[model samples]
Target: MGDHALALGTAWAGSVQAAGFIALPRRELTAALVERAGVLLDAASGTGDPAAAGAVGRWLVEAHFTHPSTLEHTLTVLGPALVRAGPDRGPAVLAALARGYAAALQERTRAEQERITAAAFVARTAAEQARWASEARFGALFADAAIGIAIVTAAGEIVEVNRALCEMFGRPADEVLHRSVDVYIPADDHEHRQTLRAMQAGELEHARLERPYAHAGGETIWTDIVLSLVRAPDGAPRFIVAMIADVTERHRLETSLRHQAEHDPLTGLPNRTLFFERLEAALEAGRHVGVCYLDVDDLKAVNDTLGHDVGDHVLQTLARRLAAEVGPGIGSGARAGAGGSGHLVARMAGDEFVVLVERPADRPDPAEPLRVAQRALDVVRRPVVSGPHRIVVSASVGVVEREDSASGSGELEKAADLMKAADTTLHWAKKDGRNRVARFDAERHRAAVARFELSARMPDALEAGEFVLDYQPLVRLTDQRLVGVEALVRWDPPGGDRIGPDVFIPLAEESGLIVPLGRWVLSEACRQGVRWREEHPDTQLFVSVNLAARQVREPGIVDVVASVLAESGWPAHALQLELTESDLMGTTGEPLDALPALAAMGVRIAIDDFGTGYSNLAYLRTLPVHALKLAGQFVTRPFATGMPDASGEDGHDGVDLEVLALLIELAHTLGLSVTAEVVETAVQLERLRKLGCDTGQGWYFAPPVPPAAVPALFSGPVGPT
Candidate 1:
């Protein structure tokens, strides 16, 4: 192989002058050709593989030995030398080398043909004889090329088309030639026309675009087209040459993939990605927009009871109905002169679906969203039959509408804010009642947002000691003596404003923060009680703290209470826990069982707000209850004026003195002490005292005071105002 490479390398060097445009020096070029010859010889003798020979052929093309005579000259000089070195394998090697050279030469020739076609426009400006010669040279490539080609005059008239172009359009050559380009390309295509105008005006040398063309067989063919402007030697625009490749199948695959990405598979509706895209586009356009967010109520129950198959069927059916009802407007309104703007119904994961409606900025309809929501609920309520079972479902809808004028700049709202508002309204609909439509209410939404913010800040507020206790006196009705104080917690933020328990207690309970917050309140109240006892040793004023229902149900509540009592050194007997009548009545199982243990620890259990709940007086006797604090209504109702009684008598109070008298008597019989709440006037205090109310607390005696103020009240018996 070494001796054969040297002889072949010498022959290759001899052919370099005829090969034309040799890029390398004589020594380097000789060495590269000798190495390639060695590889070919080795493969032919040992492995019998032709791939090595093919690689060498491609190397020659890359090394710029591109003249038509290069391959012929190479074979003529080296063929006999190779045959002499390896006679048995020499013929096979020669065949492989010829095939590789032809393949590479063909590819390079195709690329060069395209370049010469582009150069034809400039060449046509030469002498008439030279133009004819250039055309003759391009004619062979134009006739045999696989890609479609067309030559159009500057006025967009097709002067000629190659056989490939005619075949691409499924037409004969004469039928397509001499026709206006508009016969194939649509005149109404603005982008294509603009590109052509730019090229014809000498502003652009070339442009590439993908467009659809109509075939002779009445099918659309997607084509990747390259348009090159042929200009005169003076740079004046001449004819245009277009090279086109059919991309129909590739375009179809791309379209299918994009559809799968943007649409729900089961329902075939637009997914959240496409929905938000259209929403943001609408908002950016400054259109008045409406959104209806719908959630299928109890769809999970269908999946759990029947099967996921049925659940899928239900979702698909609902999606179809919503799209059919709402999408007709979408297509027509998307056009310029349509009556409406547009609408899009999309599936937003699981049982959630969202509908976006766009309206023109000149006309805004706030009630349109509500109507759409109602229509959605109506359609969803229709029964759907899947397999052998029929399923009925309802949807809760939240509707939001923003007027373009509201923003003063034609932009109605942001997409994110609109969606969030719609979601919040949907929650409101579900919360108010299922199968209902809830329109966005700014006031109610603001209050809910404020509650959420306050709830989120509660843990930090509690950690910072922002919570404080205010004592409301629980007085004795008989002697008008200050007997106890109900401990009420207040939120005093750094801003120096106090928030009452009514505003934040429910928030704490909903967020599960009440467990820790209640524990803190209990510990603080117990500590305050110990301080009061030390300040006034003679007075045995019990401190009453209201318990939230959530706190009562806590697993370690009894332990928490015991720990607080033991830590504060406050007597359990003097620390009263008040539970709302409803909370105590609802208590059962462990929560109810825990009550006795608390009572055993000497803590008094009183039912606060008595008669407000549907209480079984007989059931109250079974519990370890200490006292009943009559609901404020019972005290205020007897003296109430300007109200009708249950019997509808005008100016007669709802409850007279008799009802109050009977309530106090019933408490005595149950072995329960009674406390009359909200004692305001001297007359009411006298009436309660006459009714044998054991204790009372009202402004008539003294309003709730701080711990320091309580000692002053303890200095004397309190009298009615």
Candidate 2:
């Protein structure tokens, strides 16, 4: 067994040496492996645990035998020897050894990947450490290492060249020793010459860079070169010492990794990262640029009906078509200058691509984006044939152009804004109808930006008391007596013009700020109602506040309303919650279920803008509704000026009047009161009263006024003229 182990160990050592980069001596490595193999042979003979053979695998790795073929060689030598030693347990021992080797290799591979990830930042530190270690062992270790070294005088002539350096250039010592150091460097490498001059002049202690050197064999060899200044005993610059390690393989790997990082693997197109890099560079150079952002419509449907493989094929086909049709220089035009004058077609993400056109400052073509967008659309509309399936798809593109004169805070910010504008325009294209191109509209973008600003500031505005409510009185149509006041929210931003609900309400609703804003409105209105009732104990006035769809659907909406009423000392019956007819009719589940619970608490629920929605009388009968606010369209249509009477005289259509009358009668029949909205003229008011409308609220009563102005209207009937 001892002889067999020694023989196997000798073979293992030879195999590892052939694999290259061995850190241990042949004799020492062979002795260690022989002892490990003896233990493995014992394990196979059942004198020791078979798993103990795993340690031999670990020992091989620790000794720096990490070549890919090292394990194969170790296994070949050990497998047969162990089985011959003890046929029964040999297979188990071999399996244990293989698992250990694989685990160690996997761990080492993961660690190497991590090291590569941080290679760029750590390269200088590694070079510095290598220099220090080499200097500490300058005499023997310096000459023996695979690293190339050269000692040069302050005059830039090589005084001595190590044997390793000569071997590195594929030349002998005598030929390289007397040559100037510049002879080994590229002639056009002015930066390296300047750095070496700085070191010789005592301006710098050391410098590190990775550069390529010419080999005698007509090949380029990349090296991590560290140049250090050697000072004399008097502290004057004496000689320069240069140390270089062969990094050709590492450089190749880094270049490949960079390509992988900046490109979409499947499409082989530049990715979002590289696109933004080029876009920012163009903007920084004050170049005129345009971007066409595209999105594949119905991609999800394709992914669902056909497999993801087909979906991927579709994307790949689109990428190839876009690259072919809308590649660099497509829209640069004749005036494009050398600087920033080209185009880049990149895949931004799944089913999305962007084509960037860059032109010199002298050339500004606003229409370039539209042309590129049209071309992109044309290409995407072409049918893609994947195996067994013919897929036809369209893309919506948003186009944005930035002229050289455009002002922005910074290049990165400008690039981001351009992308945002492109994305927004793409949405417009999709919304307008897919398969079309939409150019960025400045006016529309400004409005959208303003809306976004408003939504973003809403929560803070509410918290800061920047929002206030104004009361619009709802009065009886017959006597013009004050019945109730609807609370309308207004944004009274600090040091800014008061903004009406028409502008910010939808913004609030879209952002979900309506829930909290609605809560604030309800609480404030209830408190104001309680105060007004205290001042006039005989009046039975109610306060109506509109509820947004989001608020109505809130899980704890009933609790929120009940808590507000309890905190305000206001009567629930005197508080009417109004919801638009469209919103009320579409509600289901929790929202619909909450209405009855609210009514049970003596809170009145009214459907506002009643005539505008489905107006399903049957559906209306099922809800716990107390009142209906007739939409202004129905009430004002008959009395509206210049409206021709088709079926009647006096500029009023008989059909319009009949519709208004029927709405009022139906509300009464359903045990609900009716309120007419937008009654601006005396004629409209008289007609509403004659039609038996229970109440009316509009500019005719009063525009929405502050809390103090509301009490004056309560003092008099203010009957219609």
Candidate 3:
């Protein structure tokens, strides 16, 4: 624990002292040299000597502190011997020797500290070395560092710069040292020191931005610089270290790459991804934004008529037109407000265009966004001459405006909502003959989505045993006696209330739920038909069931129908399949191949919704249709005047009278019986009967009731509702 024990600074001094001794010469030492060297060195200090000492004493004096142990021992022993020789010479020799050893110790201490610094520098990683924390030892460490690094003060002064920093700056580190960081910074960035100072002051601990710094030839080189604050443990500013890299090439490539990702090569506008990003950020930023989703309705016709090259030209023209309507993102402030501070335009996909506005003004009477949406619609509505084709492609737009806090991202919902609204409105636009803009309505969207959800769940409900057949008696048109019953599938989901097929059947077909549910209906209908036949042998008639498009399209539809018949032990003709126009649209994919197969199994196919689907009698021959059930639209409502017109065509002008005539005449021509749906009023029933309608199935006959109620219904008289 005394002076000989290891101390922080002295341990380093001791290590250096050892280093200095390793180089001491061990050449042939004559007794004369040792004695003479000792005498000369001793005499040089103060004592007179009889002879010279060896070179060891001189070596120790020259390279002071060299051979400290040896120096100490020799000085002690030799001084004593010299004292015996003479007091004057001995005392002075010892004093001179002590000074030489002390100087050597100081040199060894300096070397050890340098060695420690070099090792620390080498141990640092590449990233750390670039801007290592500044220390007084940095001067030595800087020279020893493998990568370039620099240190700057808050006032932008480059103090104690490193060699790597110099190499990065392409100048000598010393020359670069003490220069204002502004010397390397461009003039435009001179006022931007607040950023760096803030970082140094611990406001921002780190920052990375590429800026051009002047090099040796005044060559402005782009550098990717990471600046971080070197702070004391108490969090006060020590220095700012700029770990810079020459990223000129990397920057060039990255910029080139960013353009490729964010911009379209053809139109050079923001792609879908970038457009949505801006829309989402705008939404998140809580601004009033608007979006005009537009699609060129005529683009398909344009491509068909004028080749894709000219079609592309029209699209390019359309892009330019949109650009004129709404300014392209430009300038910093302007780019920040690119979509008009609240609006953005993007090609959602295909010929469809989406003009997005983030700032959807929440004013109940807001008109600016509406005006912009109208303008965008009008801008693209104009005719464009693409080469030889004068393509008159009008735009259909669905505009949606919502404020930032609109519940969700609003992009997906808004885009979909707008597209649907625009499509529905655009249909009127088309019927009114093209070129229009429409804003979205929440209620309409909600209604449609509700309907869609209802439809999509039906088939699954049926599979889960939620569907039951409700039988409505089909009475004899002449006698008012119940001949058979029509089976309607009803949904009564467990843990919920019951819903009629009217609520979900159409939906099931649209969402492809009808494929499975339709099979259920047919199978159950036939089973019920057989039960009725057993219950009332006198009422040995048929049961009619409705088929959806998805069911008709099912690959096993015919097999399912035949299986139902076999399982029910009911004749195929006793179970009638009532198919609407939507059903025929799907089944026609294979030329009525399924119809013929079902017909061979004695299953009768009746075309439901006949006149409404615009039936071309020429193609009806291809179907194995046993009967035609006129569409309810043509057989009901105010149009059902139920009177024959001058043409003797059963009042051939309205829903019931006129359409029924066309239906009956067409059915008679095809040797098929006609069943009028919804024959409610006596006038309509009598009209259909006169039109030679062979059978009637409607509320005019009986209302659908429970199976238990059916027995009571047929037990008595059954007639029009």
lDDT of candidate model 1 versus the reference: 0.79
Candidates' RMSD to native = 15.9, 12.9, 24.4
Between candidates 1 and 3, the one scoring higher on TM-score is 1
TM of each candidate vs. truth? 0.74, 0.70, 0.63
Report the C-alpha lDDT of model 3 over 221-274, residue by residue, as the tens digit.
Answer: 776566666654455676676655555543443454355456554566666777
Tens-place lDDT per residue, model 1, 1-721, is: 4887777776786686656768788889888888887787676665546577767767777787655466567766655555554544554566566556556655664575477565454354344522544566578778877678888888888887888888888999888888888777697788998998888788988898889989999999988787888776576877788888665644553464356557777799998888999889877887778999999999999999999999999999999999887654433234322566446889998999998877878887666677778878888999999989989999999988765223344333678777878899899999998899988777677788889999999999999999888788887877778888898888989976888888999899999988889999899999988988888789888989988888887778899999999999999998889998677756442226678999999999999999887567777767888899999988887877644457765343435668888888988998899998888777677778878899988787777666677777786678543
Name the runs in model 2 displaced over 4 angstroms: 1-220, 224-245, 265-267, 298-314, 331-341, 349-351, 383-393, 404-413, 423-434, 587-591, 642-650
Once fitted onto the true fold, the runs of candidate 1 whose alpha carbons sit more than 4 angstroms away are 1-146, 153-167, 232-239, 329-338, 363-367, 404-412, 587-591, 641-656, 719-721
| Worst-scoring 10-residue span by lDDT in model 3 | 1-10
Worst 10 residues of 2 by lDDT: 115-124
lDDT agreement with native, every candidate: 0.79, 0.79, 0.62
The number of clashing residue pairs in each candidate reads: 0, 0, 31
**Model 3 TM-score on a 0 to 1 scale:** 0.63
